[model samples]
Structures are given as C-alpha cells and as structure tokens.
Target: MQNDFWQKMWASGVVGFHQPEVNAYLKAHWHKLLTTDHKAMAGEVLVPLSGKSLDMLWLKEQGHDILAVELSLKALEEFIEENHLHRRFSIQDLVHERFCGYELEAMRLFCGDFFHLTREDCQDVVAVYDRAALVALPPEMRADYAKHLLEILPPDTPMLLIALDYDQSLRNGPPFAVSEQEIHTLYGEHYQIEKVQEDKFERKGVETVESTYLLNFREN
Candidate 1:
C-alpha cells in the first residue's frame, strides 16, 4: 500500500481494520505459534504493518516482547494514550518515530516503512502475527511483501496469518481478497503452510470468509 493511502486513512479516521478489542483468534492461538529453540522458546514477535492493534498489548501480557512497525505516528500516539501507557514512554527518537517500553511492557513501535526494516533492526524476531498486513496490500504488492518478510526476518520464522476471502467483484479493497492458493504461490517455497481455522461472516452486506494460517518459514 502507498504511504499516502495509509496517511490519509489515519488522518480521516477511516480505520475499520482497527479493532477496539484484541483479536479473538490471536487470544486463542498465540501460544501455538511461538518460536522454539531446540528445547526452549526465544526471540520477540514481529507485527508488521501493525496499526496500533490491541493484539500487541495482549501479546505482551503473554510475557513476550513486542516489536511493531507501523506507517503512522498518529496511530502510535493514540495507542499509547488509549492504553494509558504514555507515562512509560519517552521520545527516544523523533526522526525515526521510535519508542521503547509501554506500561512497563517490553514494547517497541517504529513509525516507518515496513519494507525498510533490516535484519539488524529485527534479528530477534522469530515469529510474526499477520492479522491485517497481507490482506491490506493489493495483488501487485503481495509477492514483494512476502519476499521482504523473508529478507528481513529469520529463516524458518513461525507466523500466524489471518486473511479474508471475499468476492473481489463486489468491492475494491485495501482489504483485498487473498486466497489460500495465492498465499502458497507467494510463500510456499519459503514456508510450510497450514490452515488452522476459519470463520464465515458478513461485512457491509457482503459475505466473507476469514481464515487463519500457520506459516513455518523453512530453513536453508
């Protein structure tokens, strides 16, 4: 998605994608997706294209460090204030729009392009929660998005991906229709894919199917 598109969305408050509560799927299945270190688990979880989702807070409650990359600073500020964590935060860097710790939680929010992140910036990331990122991109950008995740994140990183399947003819989207087959085509070689759960529902009178996928990025 273009930076302007995202900026406008935040400025205009057109964020239907921003849920008021923690995602139920994430609440239910988070532990199953943690990275294993031969015998014990290690490393932080990455939330790419993360737009101040309360899911990050929930993840922190699970005793995991949270690293989130979002395009909008407004969303980040709102997140801090809304959650009553502003006191624990300080301006670590204004130019980068980076901050550390929130409500005494080990949380970091980087207000920048997700594509610009590097291994040095996120080497500890061993897992990802993609509740909104993949489905937010258009078709042309999806393949490259997958490639970037592979480039910056650790090889064999575990990911819990939530995607929506709907008739494209009915709506033009930031919440686009991405099928299970499309996910395979994009990340199949790099990751092992499994459909863990799914739910069907209606949004704006359009029937939609939302599915959760467990992605294990394969090692070399």
Candidate 2:
C-alpha cells in the first residue's frame, strides 16, 4: 500500500488497528524481552509503523529512549495533542519530519515511510516493539517489512511481535491474517523466533487468534 493509504486511514478516523491503550501483550512480556541493563540507557527502542501508539509514552516513562516512525502526520499530531504532550515537542526536517520530545528527549517521532529508514537511524536501537506493525501489512509487503527490520536494527535486537491468524475469507485487512508459519518464513533466518503466548478472540463477530512472539536476532 502507498503512504496515502495510511494517511487516509488516519484522516478518516478508520484506525481500527490503532489501540487506545498500551497493548496487553507488550505489557505482559516487555520485561522478559527487554533487560534492564545500564547500557540500555544509551540506546533507544524502535517502533516501526507506529501510529501514535501510547506505548511509546509508556516506554519513555520506563526510562528508555524511543524512536517511533509513522506515515501519517495527522496521526503524529493527534498523538501529541491528544496526550497533552504538544508543549514538549520541537520539530525538524530530516528526510522525515522529526518531532523531538524536549524535556527528556526520551521520545523522537520520524514521520515518513518506514521503509526509507537507514541503519544509521536505528544503529542505537537495542529493542523493538511490533504490536501493530507486522500484522498491519498485507501479505505481499510483510517480507519486505521483515527485511527492513533486519537491515535497520543491530544484530540480536530483542523484539516483541504480535500477529494474527484467521480466515482471510472473513475480512479484508490492514490488520491482515499472518500465520505462525508465515512468521517463521519471514523472520526465522534472522531471528531466533519463539511463540511465547496466544489468545483466541472475536472481533466484529469474526473468530480470530492473536499470537505473540519473542524474536532475538542471531549473529549476521
């Protein structure tokens, strides 16, 4: 999908993939995936395709720096304004427009295509949080999305990934159905993948399964 696809999703308030709170899976497994090393103080965590997720704010409060990237400027603005964080930001244009959180500089949001990100932009990223990003893409884009994650982050970067498995016949999706097998195919070579937990639930009357994985990148 093009950038306008997401821009329109935000503009039209059709962000069903957008969660109102920090994702439950992240909250449950974040400590296990990310360690509290003093070295973590020097690096930031990466959140790709992040659409004004409150989880970024939550992570910032946990004392790690955050680098969140999104396609929609409207979503970014709403995120800051809605959270009453508007007063703390200053902007710069760095390929992607950069929104720097002033008080602690704990949060930095880059607004543009996530695929445009380079290794330098994420060189200090020690961890990743993929609540909505992976499952948000259609099947065709998922491989490239996986590749970009591998290319951008340093080796062995810990990741918490949440994905869905369901009948594609049931729905058309930005929140697409991504099987465990697909997850293995896409990221298995680069990451030591583990299925940590899963839950079965219904949304809009369709049966769905959500799985969470812990991805530890192996030596390249």
Candidate 3:
C-alpha cells in the first residue's frame, strides 16, 4: 500500500482493521514462541506495520520491551493519546531522515515505511509479533517483506504471524489472503514454519479462514 493510502485511512477514520483489544492469538500462543525457560525474549519485540495496537501495552505488561514501526503519524499519536501513555513516555525525534521516532519507558515507535528499516535499526530485536504486517501487503510486496525481515532479524528469532485466506473475488484487501503454501514459499528456505492454529469463520456471508504460524530460523 502507498504511504498516502494509509495516511488517508487514518485521516478518514476508515480503520476497521484496527483491533480495539489485544489479539487473542497473541495471548494464547505467545508463550509457545518463548525460550525454554519461559521468560520473555532478551531484547525488544518487533511489531512491524504497527497501528496503535493495544497489544504493545499487553506485551509491555508481560515484561517485554517494544520496537514498533508504522507509516502513519496520526495512528501513533492516537495510540499514545488514547492509551494515556504520554504520561509515561518521554517523546523524542529520531536522528534518521526518513523516519520520525517516539520513545516511551520501554517502548519505541518509528513512523515511516517498513521497507526503509535497516538491519542496524533492528539489531536488538529478539522476537517479532506480526499481527498485521504481512497480510497488509499485496502479493507482489509480500516476498520483499519476508526477505527484509530475514535480513534484519537475528538467526533463530521467532515470529508469531496471523494471516487471512479467502476468495479474492469477494473483497479487496488490506487484509489479504495468504495460504499455507504461500507462507512456505515465502519463508521455507530459511525458516522452520509451523501452523500453530487455524480457525474458519464467515464474514459477510463469505467463508474466511485465519491461520497463525510460529516461524523460527532454520539452523544453517
């Protein structure tokens, strides 16, 4: 999606995709991705394409630091204001030219394109929670999204990814359909993919299936 497209989505309040509460899949399976010791990962949890998600707060409550990226400044501002997080965070501008960043106690949000993020920027990220990032892109862009993630994240880093699959003829998407085969095609060479859960439901009379995957880098 174009930058303006998302900016307009926030501006016009056409943000049905934004969930009001923390995601159930995260609450259920987040522990499955953790180390054997049952502790949070060592560094920040990366949330790409993050849009004012309450999941960040939930993760913070679980003792994990957060590193989230979004293209819309309005979304980030709303997140801070709505959550009353402004009282706890010390906001600041990032040194980079393409991105503006805001920092709070244990969380940081970068406002910019996800593709513009570099390995150095994510060096400290130990795990990733991709509730909306992968499925938000078009088919042509998903490969690049996966590749960039592989490049930036450290080996053995785990990710909890949620995706939707349905007939494209029924609807256009920011929530695109990504099947299990496509998920493997995207990450199979480098990551061990596990379909942790699958749920089928009807949306507007159309059958839609949501799948969750736990991905870990394959040992080289």
Every model's TM-score:
0.90, 0.89, 0.94
lDDT of 1 by residue, 1-220 (tens): 5889999999999899999999998877766666422213445789988897999888777777788888888888788888877575553443343332222357777777888778876788768899989999999999999888888876667889999999999988879999999999988987888888899999777899999888875656
For lDDT, the strongest prediction is 3
- For model 1 the local lDDT of residue 99 reads 34
Candidate 3 wrong stretches, greater than 4 Å: 36-40
Cα lDDT over the full model 2? 0.79
In model 2, the worst 10-residue window by lDDT is 95-104
Better of 1 and 3 by lDDT: 3
Estimate, for each residue in 1-220, the C-alpha lDDT of model 2 and write its tens digit. Answer: 3677887889899887778988888888888776532235336889888888999888887777888888887887788779877466664433433332222266777777788778988988889888888888988888999888888887678888998888988887868899999998998887778888999999767899999998876655
Error of 1 at 22 (Å): 0.6
Q: How far is candidate 2 from the true structure (C-alpha RMSD, Å)?
A: 2.9
Q: Candidate 3 lDDT, tens digit per residue, 80-159? A: 99998767767665667668978878888899989888888887788899999988999999998998888888667788
Ranking by lDDT: 3, 1, 2
- What is the descending TM-score order? 3, 1, 2
